[model samples]
Target chain A: MMIKRLTNKLLMGIIIFHILALSLLPPFTFTEVKAAADSPGFIIQADWVVGKNMTPSIVFTETSGSDKTPMLRVHYEEAVIYGMKLTKQFSTPSGPVSLTLKADGPVRMSGMTVDTSSLSFKGACLRATENIPDAGLEDVTMVVHYMNAGGSNIEQLSLQTVDGNQGPAKPKKTQILVDLALLPYTQALKEVEKISSGKKPLVCDEPVADEGDVKPGEPKASIPDELSREDLVPGEEVIEDRVGKVTDPVTKVIDPATGVIEPVTGITDPITDPVKDIVKPVEKVIKPVTKPVKKVLKPVTKPVKKIVKPVTKPVKEVVKPVEEKLKPVTAPVKHALSESCKRVKDTKGKITKDLGLDLIDQALKEGKTLPELCKGDASLTRALEDFEDGLTDILGLDFIFKALGQDEEAKLKRMKETLKNQKDNFIISL
Target chain B: MEEREQEVQVRSGFSKKAFWTSLASGFLLLGLLLVSFGISGVACAVPIAGVGDFYVKFDQLEGTGYTFYPKLGETSSSDSSPQGTNLIKDVTIKNLQLYKDFKVGGDTIRVLITASKPVRITGLHHDAGLIQANAKFQNLTLKENNSSNWQKQFEQTSSKITLENAKLKTHYLFQETINMAGMKLTVEKIK
Candidate 1:
């Protein structure tokens, strides 16, 4: 009896709890679909099947009890009919006149096409028209035809309402105009076919050739105006070029008159000329002192010395200029100029042969070339000066400094100012 | 004399038993009356009542897109935190009080609107009873002295309170957003 009473109480509590819960639960409802075009006019819509070449007919309807009369007017700019025929007869309930229509080849209808398989109906009449008061169609089906391959067709889409309700031509025709846009697509496809036949068509299945193998004999996609000799002897020149790049070759001379020191910079390339604007004054002063001393002193006594010097050492391996030295000196200063053109000769030895102008300078300064001290030292000075001039002229200090990770002084000042402004902004925020 | 004594003892026994039984029955009857009184008080006292979908929204009145349904039954009472005494009855909240665990800058914010009052929120180490008017995290306290008994009705059965124009208070582990739609809140005895 006690257990029964307890069970009844528990059941009552559960029932009360469930009843409260059921009353408290909320319900939900969803709204229905309604879409309207932003523009006002006749709307032509169709459902098209993908991968299948078929068109659905357009149907127009006038809503009931609407104040305005609905009509469809077709203004055809052009029309083409193919592979079909048309039949027409004027029929009157009071009296009838018989009209005969003939069969044609493939019917092609332009401006619009009404495929009997695709079209539901094609004609135009307002709801006000008593003949077909309920008929919603707006355009007439005048003629039909079909076309063979490579057929000519062109047309424009327009409308003429019986009500003269025309103003600016409405552009809501975009829905129907899309199917007619095939005119441009057909033209473009023809152009693509022509292009493919004339040029190498892109092949999807062919494996891509390695860029390295396809490189040779392939016309260079980009040809520089100048070809680098470094390309010919890349291995031989790599080291000397690397050393020349690192070592400071130019000795900058400050003209006391200008109060500006022209810092000697190294030439990026041994062949490129030095910057001219910065080194012009220094070059003008140094050239007169160096060139004449080389020419006059070299010829007055060394013609005989140059002739005998190569012979003194039999193992010295005289190449071509052994015996012809005096004749060349006598030939003119031009011959001596070419003979002493060690810069050019060294370049010819290998693309990278270092002329070692620095070593030559050390040899002259150490008095190691005591026998030909004048010639060796003079050649060294000329080579060193030329290198200095080349560096000064080719590599602008301002430009190089920027490239080597240094900021412009003005930019640094601006950055400082910006930092100060940010500090002030932070204080204002606080 | 023995027989006379026996009769007196028997009369005394009967009287004693009768008195004891009467007293016991009387006490039981009093207890039943008290229990009935309590049950009727609970049945007729009326659970806190207010708007069915009562909510105080902060900032934008309508656009916060937050709805708080108070589940007063699920309240966990704690004496430590200021907003520990919550009167909310039965409901779960999304966005209005509880938020997804997320990090903003270098701080982690986790907030939930339990049935606990903002002033009695336990585990929160906030000095002020009320945090910011629109505290984004944790249970926040409404101001005292309010005419509308939303807090009262909420404590009894549950109702969805849409709170707007609230501020947030920073607590030890989290911050609490308080509904300050009005200036005052009052305490009421809920069913």
Candidate 2:
């Protein structure tokens, strides 16, 4: 059949020339992983450290105990440190030395790794206060001064809560975390899980009472004011025991059958050392030893028993003074918030549920006013004239023209009554 | 035979008119042999009388540079001439014609005359100063009292005459004359 129709037109032109050579290739791929951070791993390049408080120093990479805790965040409204001075006078162990550290205000370093394991520090600049109010921001310090090489000691760190959105609907960046081994701090507070798990050392959760109970290493007995007939030291004395290693907590006693520690000397019956393996037993069991109680005499003023025995200190005096009675300042709430103005939109609950009242609409419509629609935010023009007078007392020009015309008023009222009847039949035929 | 066939039929009628008259006499003898060579090329172009006559004959003769200047410019030497040595042998002059004269004081002026070399005069006579000759050769025959005593001694010849095979006949005049008898000059005045 003509060679099978020339092999089916050469297999349909080799399957359309391999689909036009795979549709001219190129699908997706990428590279440039890092480098090009728009340049600047360290560059003060030029600086005078303004009004001179110029403290220049450099050195960081010494961490210990949990690799010396310090995740990144160095926020800066200030910073400044430039240096050079070593023209061959290099002495160290706390003496003369200077070579690099160059910093300038808006510093960086957050969670490190813009290469060379990041957090690199070096002095001055800091600044950032301006519109304050995040509940009046309590702490923001920065200081970092170690001045002459080994003259190490001025690290004031602590300004870290700036993660991501610092608000008015978010976009101004900040991140701040510092700790570089706490060198010169000026305010500090950590425990956001120990500086976000840079690892362990924030401890203190409360555990106090072991000093007076004394059961850790035992030793006590010295009550001999001339033993009365009742001191009973007759031949009826019976004492058989053997245990050791009690370095005096008023004369030892901890022998759970030969696990040894028993120094009992003329005891009055107050022995406790069930082994806590010595070592200053709670500062030697709060010292003051010399005990002797055993009298059964009646009280000098007791007519009868006036017992108040349910005293668990009256339930720890009513649950420990309600835990130091504090927490009460109030008034900073502000929450109804279902969506702040990011770019904008509120419409005050669809104009106060169609005119019942109490509103605040303004998501910028074009009828102007409100200082002509905040013409460049002179601080949002008094919240846009109190949201345009709360949306004109909540929609009343007939519910703002029926919520601005329920679907365009019946085809614009039949095209305005057919152009008003053709202008009244052309003014009654003119 | 009937009189020998009438003499063979009158000699075959004279041999058939003599074979048609010998073929018209062989085309009239080949047209008279082409008119006898075109009459011998017109008789070889005439002239056979003396055929460019060339001759040398001598008789008593004498010659010298002859000059005779008489009038008043008088100094004369008679003979040293050899030009044409006075040639007269059969007197042949093929051409020449000349006439000149100048005798200032006694008035006889007619100067300038010229022609020479192609000539045939035979006889001539001129007066009023020269050239009167008769029976002159170049072919001649003259008489009449020998041309009247050679025209009266050519008017008492007083000097220039050079006529050869001459011709100048103002009616053989006796006055008013200017003649060049084939370059034999003559000029005359008779008042």
Candidate 3:
């Protein structure tokens, strides 16, 4: 009886442990899988952060076609690329290469590891991955051009990722049904199915037609009469075909025999890849159970059903009180949100009024205004020792959003960024 | 026979009292041990030491680099000379706060400070009359003492702190001061 009690406790502990572990496990597994996107077009971005940096994560997102096509987004706003990504592959075919530098070199590359690249900032200062051209080539140099809020691009230090030549180019393959690094660990059940039941691994073998329906190894029959070398750059390649890898609008015909996209020329039937962006969400649930359900279900569920009957009622009973406790929480949150928004608006009004530019802007929009009024500005400029003396110091913003309460820090930070970057036009308007 | 029976009862009562007292004491001792360790099941990353006399001084030695080597002990190095060459033995540098003054013949020496970490020294004892010292210097700079190297050298020899004519000059007069704190010079002559 003692041994039976011990086993019972152990089983329950394991169930709880598994539930907690499984819940915590998915995000890391998912982000990691997304970070190291296996698709050739998607450059797997791993940020090796040295400090507490709010660095942007490099995500490989399939825009549409059934989660098959991975698009690399590199959106670094305050940067200029010297080696333009002319191709869809984001390659540096040829450019002036100054690879070596001081111990703290601008560019860093490690084979299969991101070390020695200690580029991080207090905020998202490094190259953003949201706007990078989703091309196939492996390496490109990123020269972050610092620009003033006044829209003048200035020469800033350049930073580059290590060359792709250091490691094997990601093997060209069909869309990855499952992330490989998460393999042998996550989705153990799915792997077991492949091994145990001789099931083939999941792959989207859809043929992505490009260049006037040119199949792989098939030359384009009729090139555009006015094709320039610049146009031949991979990026200019048809977004239609590139996007087709995920969803083939033209060739809806899947060669049933090969389970691949058929090389049907000029077929205009469009079809959406059913699995687009849905793999991880669905697989996150399915993969955990895939193994445990088969093994654990037989033994565990028999006991689980027995235990769950008793446990379910208590859980339901416990949930009722939690719901009662949480019901009041919504009222405060709503009240706080309404209060903060009001404060933000009030502060905005104060800033605009203090700037004394409201009347100036209204005049400018009506097509007659201030800078024009300053045609004799030099006459007044002569009276002032310096033109800067005429302008008063900008101040008194700290008290603007005091009522933001909980959101004060974040809102203040956003206001600071807006004033600094003057991007999204909010700062300029202020 | 009745008295003997009473005596037996008294001894049994005393043994029971002793057992309970010892059990309570055991628990109290365990709690104290946990307190000293700073662990109540969960432990802090660094074990904090009680305020003590021990300290690690990297700045006391004249050529030792750093304006303020992190104070590691309750007290700093005193003006007193090392009576013996083995100044340190089996000491763990907790990187605690410390203060010390190093003077040769009432003359102060320049110090190089490193904010990084403290180097651990062990078994620093003078073997014989001669304290042999060997050290490696990186990015070392030498500067002449503005006042006098002779008086400083005199104080060094008198304290049994034997600095060779050249090494003494290297340390005091023509000394190369490392601007870093992490670098440690192992005093082989004294130890």
Candidate 4:
């Protein structure tokens, strides 16, 4: 009766313990899902690929809009377009002419479009170059199409050979055709294609009815409700199976006598056995030889150590006071030097502030001339002179001037002469 | 009788030639003053404040430009170097007006620049308050600040370089020759 009672108690204890352990374990083990990487801001593809240096002409087609005023707009988000070129080819009276338009620097376009059967660029100066092989025509007329506030319009503009000294005239119009091959193949486009091909599931499609124990006329199980039910119902049998599988391998490898795993023992025994065998024999051979040597050295070293300690203690004691005594003497001198330096720095700041050197600096950065800066302030002039003198001294300008005396004079004279001759080009007025 | 004789000698000492020469000299001095005043007036009349394009090419330009020196008890390795280069630092200015335009060479390019604040070229001596313009550069190369061959590389000629609304500060600028067109310089007192 007592044995039966003890067995029941043990069984109950095991069940209670498992309940507590299961409650303490996490409810769900969620797998982390990584987000997709961001796509590029925009991509440009041209129909006719050429050398990397040469920018191919691009035609943007209107994809979505009303039939009457079809428009395609691209917002660059103030991004600078580097090495942008616009090329137009036409059969002129002379021959087939290719006119390429390029900006002097990177073009910053906020929003633009190559649609409405016209090409219009705003807020940028473009220079045009023509490739005329025969040189048969000094000028050519080309029909240009452009868009404005009033909508797209066509204009005939004349193109003249830019003078060598003058700026190039603006090009008015060029005809452009849509190239279907250059459309960007993005993920959104793929989704659109799937939707158009009747492959994607529609919202109106009915859900598959659940089979088995669900009764008729009762509220159907929604996706979230079903998921919640599955999550709440813990897989006790599966957990127990996994735990059994994990322990089975461990139990097979473990040694009953040592409680060490047999695999670990197998790995370490070969390496440790050879080392132990070699060390035991060497230790036995070295023991007698080392013992006599240790005994002899210990007696000899004791007297020398005793003698050296006494000598070193006295020397250290003597040097300590000297070092202490010198510290006070040297500290005041160091402090005085630092103090003087601080004072000099303070004075320099005061002087710079007093003479409005900072103001002069500000004015100079604002593009003010030195003469204008020092016009009324005599103190400022003196300060500037002093500053210049200091710089001159540091750079050793006196020596440089002495070395390049005549040459320097001649250079200055020539510069003045050149400036005077180009007086119309160099005007300074206020 | 002696006073009357002294008066007579004084009158004779003042001859017609002396009188005419003195009068001519006075008129010449007056003319010189008027001419100088007119020249100065013309200089002040032409204002450099206007929206226009400018271009300059330095075939050969030579100047100390701007120089900066390290302060007392400071090493060159410290932040005292100009434009991150181991060059001297002397003066700092907020605004400087520079204007000029003329062509000495063939095929000139024009630039118009405007800006809110002055565009300062530190290593270069030239200064401008603000610039807003279209600019073009050809065959421009910038040498590294720490390079030992900076001076030699700088001496090599460049085709062109255009900067707009740029605050450029350099150690020094020395060009052998220059060509400029449509340049204007303006200097005004800060209110």
Candidate 5:
């Protein structure tokens, strides 16, 4: 009975210990419990696994590291892989040419086995290695390391097997139908095709028939030796007569040089002659009345003049010295003010030159009116306005015009003239 | 006779108490074992680490509505064609195999892949990469620019592009929109 009790305690202790040990052991030891299917699959071990639009059915192999959960299956449906590189050395006529192909596109795969210590989805590390449901990721970029040797055109490429053997004895025939627009270098290809097919040259040397030339056996209508206004229209002669009569007087009145209208040379003579005859009778009647009034005013003016002359002379004498005394003080002040204004102008000139504002000013000086320079250029107009405002703040409205060696009123007048000319041209041109 | 009966009763009572204790302990052990199995099952669900170098191969590959940009720039003198965005309507590959090689001690460990069916992808956009392939075109057209300032001398287009017994290699292959049929994998070691 003592031995049975001892054995029971010992067995319990052993069972507890075994359970603890089994629990402590890594879970990978039990992977045999869930056997993977025997089917066609792929295994890829990349230093870095980065992709997107991945709906992959992936299985993870056991690995050692802090990351306990490794991605087992990913159903990367439409995944974009970035920076995938492959290189091969080929024997060419020149020498050995190393060719490297880099690709980035949507990849489709089936039965793929991915092995990586680090696997991330959308840049975040997967915490667990389980069947990742549809991981529809977009824009997964990766970095690949490789070397580039030199240039090898795709046209120069030749078939080679995995064992690096040359072209096959009997090449398989394949046909690809492609749209012309989808292909690159379309125009170049068309030209080559044209040349190879011996098509007609784009530029032909054949002489073209003139539209005015009359062909053999074709009837030609006779043309009149001269064109007549009366033949073209029945009332054209009368219209010409009326038009000439109206234009003759207008031409005589308008001065060509000034583009201004002047009265016809003899137009005012008849009116002036009639006015002179009427004025002669009226003048005779008014003469006697005017003579009496003038005699009455002459006596009153003499006395007043004598009294005012003495007072004005004394006032003028007193003001002369005061004016002379103030000249010395005011002259230097005016000179200093002018000098400061000139200095400000000079500083502004420098700033304008640095800012390229001087180019506009130069163009203005070159006879480009403000309107002409600012036409079709809103930014230039705004810049000029801003510059004008800056000058107005520092000096005054007329300062910029003065600095340009022109009067503000003259500049405005010129601008108006330019605008008027432009408007007139716009109307006439249409 | 009375003393012997009392001793027998005490011994029976002790045995019954010991039996109950043993039975309780056995139940506790079973519960602990179940809890441990549950924990391990959860752990196993986590991703296993991967081993090896990157390698992939396909028996046949086909793509539709393909477009590629050479990005040769605007000048005629520039010969360097950089990678740009490329597009395809859909793509399919048959008998696909991929392998990742690893060095364990002196031997190389890799995943061996058998034959597989077709993998399909739709609406693929390729951003950048270089590709080398043997190709031939039918009804090809070539246009030339003779301008002194032009960097590229000629441009080409074709009604059809046929690649037979052609080997295509790529560097930096990044893509999108993929689907694969069956998958089978096995690991192998080589010295």
Candidate 6:
């Protein structure tokens, strides 16, 4: 009787636990990937089968599945998607799926990270090639071996919801792949414009059911609810902030020189003027020190120049003619300065490259947001363009310095000053 | 004595029955609750695609291309260093889309929204002077079948890197371009 009573108590605890677990489990969410042009937003390929060509177009796939995987594991999710397609199994929104493909042709697969410039791959064979041949067969499946291949942050993806019932675009010899898109190009673009700000495309198999529990009006798929009490529907403002990306006003800084806002400074200030903000304070500190120092130097230098000039004048005239006999300089620096303004080479190795394009491409392929990619593009266009405009001025100064027979060190100093001056007073005529 | 013992036995039996009946009812209650929770859990599973479909498209290249660096720091890596190779290509650029914001080392350079097929990017790197990238092209067939619509590709490295804007003739390219569009780039600080 005691044993029976104990058993009854144990059963009661188990029953209570089961009910509580069921209530707390979160809802099952399916993240859909759809290309607006070729495919509508997210889609489901229910009951997909291997095509008649004996090759599969889309292997096994899940609508809402894991896009994250450990580095050592085959992007297990991508692996399953491709593996299932390779094995020819139908995948569901929440069903377990896997796929494996061997290179029958020159195929490339790469793992993408949130940092576009990052070369790390979280799963599978990390491979990529710039070149790929035209399709020899119609139904050969091209696998997406990337976790973020759908470009979650960029809101870009090509998802097809094809199942067994849906057949291939009728195979043709000269079939152009242009019309295979789900929506017409222009029409799809209109759709993207309308939704670009408000909606976020659930990444490739990335479930975004911020709404944890499935309410009556919510999606009705048989997903195990892993309900957590704290999970709340994300506010629309957050989504809009990420998607709409309203350009916050460009911050402006006043230029001390002109008492007006200068094109933003220090982004790539050649002069490295991120300290422009502290320039006033620094000037204040230096003014006191420099004022007395300059006063002393000025009196000393004047006496020294007066004494040296008379003595040097007689010798300089003798040296002047000798220097004049030197080789003729090509396109006197003045002519070169003006002529080369339209065409000139900056110092052989002074220009700075933004690396923006390369990093952006990598970022897009890796699927990072614009702001993230922006970090890679450190450009000071206003500064650079102004510097370019000041090229003539710098070159003219170079010639003057050379004509004065200044030493190389003095020439370099003047060049630096010229650049600073350019930044202060550059006005592009053209 | 026998009559008293008979009364005690009848009371004990009644007490045991009451205990068993209450226990059975408790178990029955738990079982019903378990079923109800399980059913509700199943009902809450939401199909993601059922959230409704949006078939919108982007007509413009909506972003700043990249941050332009006019000057590198005294010890910038891009200065006086031979970056990656610059393999030039002579292919007409059609339907190019710039990003909303471009950066020095990261940003989208080549986005073929509705342009020719198989556009190849050879190398795109930043230098101390300005931003430069190289693209390659093969036998490009224009959509309008006008093969001779455009001239040779844009190719120039070093000082000859063209600063002025130029145009490329297109065959069946549709829509106007917006490089400086709605997107504005924000540069808070630079290294």
Instruction: Give the TM-score comparing model 2 with the true structure, all chains together.
Output: 0.14
Worst 10 residues of 1 chain B by lDDT: B137-146
Write candidate 1's Cα lDDT for B1-191 as tens digits. Answer: 99999988977764656765885686567445434533342222222211111222233111111111111111122222222122222112223332223243365533222222222111111121222221121111111111122212111011122223443322212212222111222222222
Q: Model 3 off-target regions past 4 Å?
A: A1-134, A138-430, B1-191
Which candidate comes out best when scored by TM-score? 5
Candidate 2, superposed: residue stretches over 4 Å from native = A1-27, A30-73, A81-195, A199-382, A385-430, B1-191
Best by lDDT: 5
Please report how far candidate 1 places residue A234 from its true position, in Å: 56
TM-score of each: 0.10, 0.14, 0.16, 0.17, 0.21, 0.16
Stretches of candidate 4 above 4 Å error? A1-71, A77-80, A86-430, B1-191
In model 3, what is the error at residue A223, expressed in angstroms?
A: 13
Window of ten residues with lowest summed lDDT in model 5 chain A: A143-152
Provide backbone clash counts, one per model: 92, 49, 46, 58, 83, 65
| Residue A391 lDDT (model 5) | 34
**lDDT string, candidate 1, A1-430, tens digits:** 9999999999999999999998786532111111111112222222210111212222221211111211222212122332222221111222221112121222222223121101212222111101221222312232111111111121111111111122222222222223333335456445434433443211111122322222222222232224333354545442222222346656888666856778989867566776667544443443444444444434465444444344464575556766644544444342242223454334432211122333234334554421232244464444444543332222112222232254434322322222221212121110
For candidate 4, give the lDDT of residue A234.
Answer: 62
The CAPRI quality class of candidate 4 comes to incorrect
State the lDDT of candidate 5 residue by residue for A320-340, as single tens digits. 444444445544332222222
lDDT assessment of candidate 5: 0.34
DockQ of each: 0.01, 0.00, 0.01, 0.01, 0.04, 0.01
Q: Which of 3 and 4 is the better model by lDDT?
A: 4
Comparing 5 and 6 by lDDT, which wins?
Answer: 5
Interface RMSD of 6: 21.7
What clash count does candidate 1 reach? 92
